[model samples]
Target: MSTGYDYSWFILTQSIIKKEFALSGSEQNPDLTGKSWRMTLRRATNKGAPAPVEAFKSHGVDFIVRDRIEDLVAEMNKLAGNDLLKLEHIRMQIEARDREIVNPYVKDAQVMNIHNARRYIGDRLIRTAAPHRILDPAQGPLIAVKLNILTRKTLGGFETDLDSRVFGGEGSIIPGLYAVGEAAGFGGGGVHGYRSLEGTFLGGCLFSGRNAGRAAAKAVG
Candidate 1:
């Protein structure tokens, strides 16, 4: 319940937000990495929030990122004020594909587990002649962000900061607060954390969701 996130975490997020955020420019389409899209209103959003970059269009069906939808709706609704579109209507608008500038998917993970600091994230401050530290899409492809995450010690029988299993032991004590997929350490065999992986979040969500449903059913019974 009380996962103690320290002040450093706040500072880190602020620093990261500043570095990661971009100011959207008109005449240019936003292209989020995944099917995600979030844009400022046709009026006043300057921060370059990621948006879907049109290439996702295929025949009629298309993918939409949930994060983008939430963000775009919030921004537009801010402009709409009391006239905010109904959630259903908004859904209709979404299905209608109303966004102009958009981005695809984005990095949803709060952290990345690396094998070594210099090799993986790399020496950000001296990455290039341009004087770099993470890659920015605006700077072109091959974007990279060399992060130096805290290397917390793993004592085992608990969740590691990297969301890894430090050792095989009696797992989490969420108290019938079920967990599955990566939460319960799926496919992470032997390693303490995930060195590199993607889409685990979605898979984890599905696994956990199904369990929650089953638990609910059992409780009801």
Candidate 2:
């Protein structure tokens, strides 16, 4: 839902979601819920977003599918029952973002982040898409979604270390106890440091969970 305007939302192409869209809940992601790594990997490398995302595009109330930006904006404005969005304004912003794809070292922070993500073996294999222009016809027909808030995870909480041991105000590890997952602030009380990004929460939780289990096991042994 980021298009550089507080009042405006983003219009993602079919290509964008394939790498980024991951629906939460058991019913939403069968592979994930079933704990099948093979199926989950296949889903990631699949031609499009998971089944649930496609279902949303086809049936969700907030979604609008269109081949042209003009038509997409028109439908979006109509859905909101307001003229607050302008075609020219939206086009200008999209064009600007698309322009960043050409740079080897892009100035656009989001685009740069996309490139950064692709550098990781796991992310490159399935998580992030290669840098490409948003308006590129090959990646379209455009998909505009009227996004609604769905809380997937919390931001920050109790601080901990690599072993998931809670830290006291005096910066010492509190003994005989451990924290992990969301309880460890999704890893060391905000793994992203000063600036957190989307999709990092689960990874933090998994990492801390392992550390906590290992530490607690050794402590008892």
Candidate 3:
């Protein structure tokens, strides 16, 4: 769903349950449920390789590389063990996006966002890629990264007081019970309130931990 310079590109599949994830085997298999794959396709370059790509490579994560789009699509299908992604469908989408890039006025939200991000000097210099067609021969050979989603943190948690004391169902603090950091819901249960800015949770965790430590120390004293 997001794209950046050589370092960042993310695409989240739209439907949680789709035909792409359905395996040929029995539906009774527990492992088959809720399984899906996300892929990032980018132009291969010697320079400006994304840090994650390097790290992943060093850690032995497999990467698909091909000189031709057809070859790339074939590899992707081979890896997925399914013919979910059609070469023509992928080509059509890429060509459509490329066409918008050449247009003086673009209506694509993602392309517009990319342009908007580049207006900032920092993003322009390091975080955003120059708008280009992925199919451009000069940009090949292409790289495909298969991604897996991992749960990092919870946005919501136990409701707590400023001192990190856990609040009960009746809205009373439970004796000798406390929650801190993410357990205190990042910042007492509604600090993020359904959404949060990246890296802000660290601050909330630290602040809540500090409050809990002080409060516990004072109470014990």
Which predicted model would earn the best lDDT? 2
Q: Name the lDDT value of residue 45 in candidate 3.
A: 23
Give the range of the ten consecutive residues with the poorest summed lDDT in model 3: 11-20
Candidate 1 residue 133 Cα shift, in angstroms, is 16
- Every candidate's CA RMSD: 18.3, 7.4, 12.9
Flag regions of model 1 displaced more than 4 Å.
1-29, 32-146, 151-177, 186-196
Candidate 1 per-residue C-alpha lDDT over 164-212 given as tens digits, one digit per residue, 9 for 90 to 100:
2232346444433444444445424223345524323445446545655
Q: Which segments of candidate 2 are over 4 A away from where they belong?
A: 1-8, 35-38, 149-221
lDDT of 1 at 117: 29
Which 10-residue window in model 1 sums to the lowest lDDT? Answer: 6-15
Task: Report the candidate with higher lDDT, 2 versus 3.
Answer: 2
Stretches of candidate 3 above 4 Å error?
1-46, 50-52, 57-63, 187-189, 192-194
- The alpha-carbon deviation from the true structure for residue 154 of candidate 2, after best TM-score superposition, in angstroms, is 10
Query: lDDT order of candidates, best first?
Result: 2, 3, 1
RMSD of 2: 7.4
Best by TM-score: 3
lDDT of 2 by residue, 1-221 (tens): 36544444668888887777767555778776789898788865666677788888899888898989999999999988888889999999889878778777677787778888888988887677777777888888798887665555556677777778899989998897787777668833368664556556678788888878998999899
Candidates 1 and 2, the one with greater TM-score: 2
